[model samples]
Target chain A: MSRKLLETEGPKWVAQGIITAEQQQRLTALYPEEGRVVGLLPLLGSLLVGLSALSLIAANWQGLPELVRLLLLLGSMGGAYAAGEYFLRRGANDSLGIGLVGLGLILFGAGIVLTSQMYQLIGYDVTGLLAWAAAGAALTFLYQSRFLFALTVCIGGIVQGYSTGQLSGFSYFTAALTVGGLGWYWWRRPDAVLGGVLASGILWQAGLLISFLHAKITWFFIPAMLVYAAGDWQPDRPAGRALQAPPLVAAFLFTFGLALYGETDTYAGLLRPPLLAYLSALLAVLALSAAGKRARGRLGSLTDWLLLLPGFYLPSGLALAVATLVVLYAYSGAVLWRAQQEHNPDRITLGITLFILTTMAAYFKLTWAFMDKSLFFLCGGALLLGLSWYLRRAAARALPPKSE
Target chain B: MATPLPLARRHRLVLLAVAVQALFIIGVAAAGYATTAWGRTITLRTAPVDPRDLLYGDYVRLHYTISQLPRRLWRETNREARPNEPVYVVLQPAHGAYEALGVYASKPAIEPRQAVLRGWITNSWRHGLRIRYGLERYYVPEGEGRKLEKRPVLLVKVSIAPWGQARITAVNALAK
Candidate 1:
C-alpha cells in the first residue's frame, strides 16, 4: 500500500483498537516516502541540456570538419557509455543507468550512419547495421535488462526493414539474430511484457519478409503460427499467453475479414497458397502446439486454434461467410464457457465482448441488405441489449460473491 | 533466467562491446576512404530529376543512365532475371561517361578498360531491367544539393573498390 493510504488509515486502526499507536508508528515507518519527484527534476534538466546539444550539433553537422564530426560522434558515444557504467556501479538509479546505456547503443547506430554518409559511402550489404543489432543483443544479455531486450528487438526490425525496403534484399541473418538472440533470451527469462514485444517484433519482420518475396499473404500465418507454437512451449503460463496473443489476434482479424468479405471470389482466391505445402506446414505447427498444450495441461486453450480453420478454401459464397461466422461464434463461446468454468472475471469480460462483437457482425451481415433501415437499427439495439443482459447475468451467477 | 554476470566481468564485456562498436564505425569510415584511394574511378551520367524531387534532406537522389538497360544485356539466358537479384554490370567508357556493356548474374572477366559495378535488379520486364547500384544517393554538403538539381544532366564520379564496394565520389554538371 502507499504511504498516503497508510497515513490516512493507520490512526483509525489504532483508534479502533486493531493496533496500538506504537505499532501504528512502526508500520508507518515501514513505508518511507519516495523521492521520485525530486529525482525527476535533474533528469528533466539533463534531458533538456542533451536535446539542446543535439540540436546544435545537428545544425552545424555539415559545416564541421570531417575529423571533428567523427571525433564528436565517438566521444559522445563513449561518454554515454562511461556515464552509464558509473551510474550502474553507483546502484542508486538502475533505470537511469540502463537508459544511458541504451542511449549509447542508439548513438552507436547513428555513428555508423553518419560515418558512412561522411565519405558518401554506400554499403550494398547489411553488415554495418547488423553490428548495431548484434551490440544491442549483447548488451541485453550482459545487463539482463528487459529494456535492452526490447530495444534489440526494435533494432532488428529497423535493420530488416532497411535491408528489404531500401536495399531490396531480405536480411535473413538479421531475422535469425532476432529469433535466435532475443528469442532465446525471452525463452529463458519469460517476461510477459517482453514476450509480447518480442512476438510483435518477430511478426513485423516476418511481414516484411513476406512482402519482400511477394508471396501470397496467407503464407504469413506460417511464421506467425510458428511464433504462437513457440509460446506454447514456454513453461511460464502468463508470459506464454502474452506471446501467443499477437498471432491469435492476427488470426482472428483475418478470419473476421473473411467473414465480411468472403463473398468475393477474388479475395478468397488471393488467400489460397499451394494447398498441400501450406496445410502440411500448418499441421506441423498444430501438432507442436498440441503437444505443448498437453505437456502444460492447458489443452482447454486449444479452442483458440478454431479461428485458424481454412474456411476460405470453401467456394466463395454465402457458405464461406456463414462458415467463418460459425467458427467465430464457436471460438468466442468456448472462451466464455472456459472463462466461466475457471471463474476468471477478466476472461469472462473478454469473452462477453467478443460474443457481442460477433453478434453484431452476424446481424449486420445477414440483415443489412434486406431489412428496413429503422427496423434494422431497432432490431440491432434490442438484440444487443438482450444479449448483454443475458451474458452479464450468466457472468454474475458464475462468479463468486465479492466480499469487498 | 541466466544469472547476470558478475559486475567486474559485466563491466569488461560492456567495455569490449563498446570498443568493438567504436571500431566498427571507424572501419566503415576507413572503408569509405579506402574505396576512393585504392579503387578504379568511373564517370556515369544522370538524367536530371525535378529539383524538388532531388533534394531530400542533405542527399540528392541520382538516376544514373545505366539504371535501366535493355534486357538483351542480361547475359544469363537460361533463367529469367529475378527482382532483387545481385548482378554485375560491366561498363566501358563511351563519350565522357561509362555505359553498361553487359549484365551478368556473376562477375564477368572484363578488359583492362572495362569496369564491373555490382547492382541489384529492382525490376525486370520483357524488354528492360531496372537496377539499383546503391550509389544512387549522393550526400551533399549542407545546402549544396539544391544547386545540382537544376542541371539538365550531371556526371557522377564513382569509385568501385576491387573488393566489390562502390561509392559516389563526386558529382558535377555536364559542360554545355
Candidate 2:
C-alpha cells in the first residue's frame, strides 16, 4: 500500500500480467513520497535556536530584574502559543504546531513556579499550580489533540504529586478535574492510545490517593476497579480494552506477588482490610463491571477478574500458596483459551507468555527446596521449551490457512 | 468521534486560553508583591547548619529554631499530635527573636504581641514535635547560595499575609 512497496513490486505484477505497466505507474503515483527528511531540517534548526535562547536566559536569570524576568516568562510563553496558532492556521506541519502548543503549556507551568520563586512566596495550598493543570485541560479541549490530552494527564499527576508530597494535603479538586475533563474527552473520542494513557494516568493518581490516606494498600483496587468498570462501559472495543490493560496488569502483578509471598502470615495480614467493607466495595464495582460487560456482549472478558480473587484471606501456609497458584493457572489458562477461540496471534503470544510465567513461579515455589539445583534448571528449561513448542504448534493449527 | 470545532472558534479559544494563562502568571506575581506590601513581617531565627548539608544545590537549607518544639507546648489536650497534621503555632517575641508560645490544632486567639503561623507536623516523639513551615529552602542567586550556606546561623524575615500565605522576605546571617 506504500509507494515504496509499489516501486519495488510493481514490475513483478506487470510481468505476470496482473496489471499493465501504465496501470502500475498510476498505482505507484497514488502514494506520494513524503517530505519527511526535508521537514526535519527546519525542525532541527528551530530546536538549536530555541536551545540557545534557553541557555542564554538561564545564564542571566539571576541578574535579570524582577520585571524583566516576569516579562521574559510571559513573552516566551506567548510567543510559543502565537507561533503554534500561526502554524495551525497555515494548515501544514500539524505536529510542529501541536508540539509548540505543548511547549507553551510547559512554559505556563514554569511561569507559575518562577513567578512564585521570584518573590520568595509560598502557597500553602495547590491553588497556584492547580491553574497549570486547568490550563492544560483547556488547551486539550480547544486543540482536540491527543498530544495535548497526554500532556494534561501528566500535568495532573505533577500537581497531585506536589500537593501531597510538598503541601501534605491531597487536592481532590485537581483529581476530579483530570477525571472529569480528560475523562469526558476520552469518552467522546475513544482512541486506543489515548485511552491507555488516560487509564494509566488515572491509576497513578489513584495510587497516590491511597498512599495519601495511609490506607491499607488493598484500598487501591476500589478506585482501580472503578477505572476498569468505566472502560467496560466504553462503546469502542479496542479502546475499552486499552483502558482496561493497566488495571488488569496491576491486578495480575499483585496476584503474582501474592503467590510468591503468600506463605508469610505477616504480609497477608497487612493486605487484609476491614473484610466486610472491602468486600462490599469490591463487589459493587464488580457488579458494575459485569453489567457493562453484559451490555456490550463482552462477558467473555469477565474472566479477567480472576486475578482479583481475595486468596490472601486464607490463613497463610502451604494451602494459601497452592490456592494462589491455582488462581494464576486458571487465569492464564482462560487467556490461552480465549486467544485460541478468537484466533488472535498477538493474544496467543501473550497467553503463552503468561502461562509459561505461571509455570515457572509454580515450579520455583513447589520444587526449589526439594530438587537438586542442576536437575531443577535442566527440568525447568526443558519444560518451558516444550510448553512453548506445543503452544506455538497448537496456535498454528488453530489459525485459518493464509491466502498468500 | 465528535467533530473538531471550526478553525475560527478554535483559534479564539486558544487565544483566550493563552491570555488567561498570561494573566494567571501576572496574578501570581501580584500576589507575591501584595504579600510583602500588605502583610506583617516577623523575624525567625535559624538553627546552625552543618556545612556538608549545604553542598547540594543553588538553595540553602535553613533549619529555623521553631522547627522543633517541646511536647508540652502542644496545646491539644484531647488527642495526640499526628504527623503531617496542619497546626497553628503562636509565636511571641522573646529575647531578640520570636519563639513558639504554643502549638494548637486550630488557630488560637493571639494577644497584641503574639502571631500565629501555620505549619505541618513532620514528626513527633516522646519529648518534642518537628514542624515544617514551607520556608525551609532559600533559593539564592547563582554562586551566592554557597556564600549564604557558610553562615552558622541566620535570621530569616518572613511576611505572613492575612490570607494565610507566607514568604521569606530576607535572610541575614545572625551576628555573633
Candidate 3:
C-alpha cells in the first residue's frame, strides 16, 4: 500500500474506533517515506557502455597486437568489476554498482569471444557462453543481482541452443544449473522465486526444442508439452502469483512451431503420425493435471489452458487448426462473461488477450490471393483495434467504483 | 543474500572474484597465443562448407580439405571410424594442400612437424569417415570474412601443437 493512502486513512480509522492515534502513528512509521525502488538510469548507462565495448572489440580493423587485444579484454573486464565493487561499498550507489557489475559480466563474455576471434578457435561454440552463464549464475547467487539473473538466463539459453544435444553434455550442465540456480534463488529471495522458475524453464526447454528440431520435428511436441505442464508447479505462496515460466515458454514454442507448420508442409519424420499423435495426447493429459493444480488458486483463469488444448488434436490439418480456434474463442468468451458477472478485472483482461492471440494464430492458416493479402492484413489489424477498444469499454463498465 | 557480509570483507571477496574472472578472460587469450607461437604452421586449401556461418561477422566457419576424408584414407581394420571416437588425421604436405594419409583410431606419433590433426567422428559408416577438425572456425575482422571466402580461392594457414591444440593463423585469398 502507498504511504499517502495509509496516512490519509489513519486518522479516519482512529476516529471510527478502529485504533488509537498512537497505533495509527506506529502503522505509518512501519513504511518509509520513500521506498527503495531501483533506479533505471545507471543500468541503461552501463548497458550502452557494454555495447560500445563489444562493438569496439568486434570491429577490429586495425589488426592490433594480439597481446593488446588480450590486455584490452582483461583490463575492461577486471576494471569494470573493480570499479563496480568500489562504488558498491557506498550504500546509495547500489544501482550504479549493479550496473557496473553487469558491464563487467558482459565484458567478461566478450573477452572470451574476442580471445577466440584473435586465435580463431573452433568447436568452442557453446563453451564460452556456458562458461559466461556459469560465472553470471555464481555472481547472481552471491550478490543476488537481478541483472545477473537475467543475463545468466539469456546466456544459458543461448548455450543450450548452441550445444548439439544432451549427448554433447553441455545441455546437461545447463539443466543442472537451472535446478541449482532456482533452489538458490528460492532460498535467498522469496520474492524472486517466480523469476527463478521462469529462467529455469528457459534453460530446460531451449535445449529440448533445438535437439528435437535437429532430430525429429514430431518429437518436439513432447518437450513443449512437458515444459507447459511443469509451468504449473509454482510455489504454494503469493510469490508464485506471477506469470509461471513453463506455460509461457510452452506458448512461445507453440507460436513458433505452429508458424512453421503453417508455413512449410513437411511429411518426413522419424515416427509415424499415429504414434506422434498418441504421444501428444498423453502429454496433453499430463499438462491438464498440472494446470488443474495451478488453477487451485490462480488468476488469468482461461489463459493457462489455451496452449495445452490444441496439442490434444495434433498433426492437425490447416482446416482443423483453424476450426479448433473456434473452440478457443468460445472458451474465452465464456470466461469473459463469467468475469463480467463476478467483476473480476484480471479474468476479463486475460479473456480479451487470449481471444486476440487465437485470432492472430488463426490468421496464418488463411490463404489470400497475392493482390488481396495487404488488404486482408490491414482489415484484420483494424478489426483487432476495434475489438480492443470494445473490450476496454466493457471492462471499464464492469469494474466497481474505487473505495477510499 | 544470507546475513549481509561485513562491508570490508565483501569488498575483498568482490576484488578476488573480479581478479579471478579477469585471469580467466586473459588466460584464454594466453592459451590462444601459446598454441600459435609454439605450434608448427601448415597451409591447407579451403573446401566449400554450408558457408552461412562463415560469411557473417567476426567468426568464419572454415571447412578444410582434411575435414572431408575419403574412405581409402581410413586405414583401420574396420571400414569406418568408431562413432564419437577421436580420429587423428595424419597429414603430409601434398602438391598444394595437406593431404590426410590416414585416419587413426588413436593418436599416432610421427617425426616433429609431421601434422596429426585430431577430431571426433560424427557418424562413420562404410564408404565414408565424417570428422570435424577443431580447426573449422577461422575468425576474421567484421565484413572481411566474405571476401576471403571468394570461391576457387581460399587458403588457410593453421598452426598446430601437441594433443591436437590448434589455431588459425591466417586465411589468405590466393588467386587461381
Candidate of highest TM-score: 2
Considering summed lDDT, which 10 consecutive residues are worst modelled in model 2 chain A? A261-270
- Across A265-324, the per-residue lDDT of candidate 2 in tens digits comes to 878757889989999999999999999999999999999999889887889988988999
* Model 2 C-alpha lDDT versus the unseen true structure: 0.91
Q: Tell me the DockQ of each model, to 2 decimals.
A: 0.67, 0.74, 0.36
TM-score of 1: 0.93
Using DockQ, give the best candidate's number. Answer: 2
Question: Which pairs clash in the backbone of model 2?
Answer: none
Every model: iRMSD: 1.6, 1.3, 3.4
Q: Which RMSD values do the candidates have, in order?
A: 2.4, 1.9, 8.0
Using TM-score as the yardstick, the better of models 1 and 3 is 1
Better of 1 and 2 by lDDT: 1
lDDT of 3 by residue, A41-62 (tens): 6767878997897687556633
Off by over 4 Å in 2: A9-21, B51-57, B142-150
Per-candidate clashes come to 0, 0, 0
* Superposed model 3: Cα runs more than 4 Å off: A1-64, A164-170, A182-209, A212-231, A236-246, A252-303, A310-319, A330-343, A356-398, B1-6, B33-90, B101-157, B169-176
Give the CAPRI rating of model 2: medium
Cα deviation of A383, candidate 2, in Å: 1.1
lDDT tens readout by residue for model 2, B1-176: 69989998888888899999999999999999898988899999988778668645657788889999999999999999988898999999987889999999998888987888999999999999999988888877767776776788888999988887888998887787
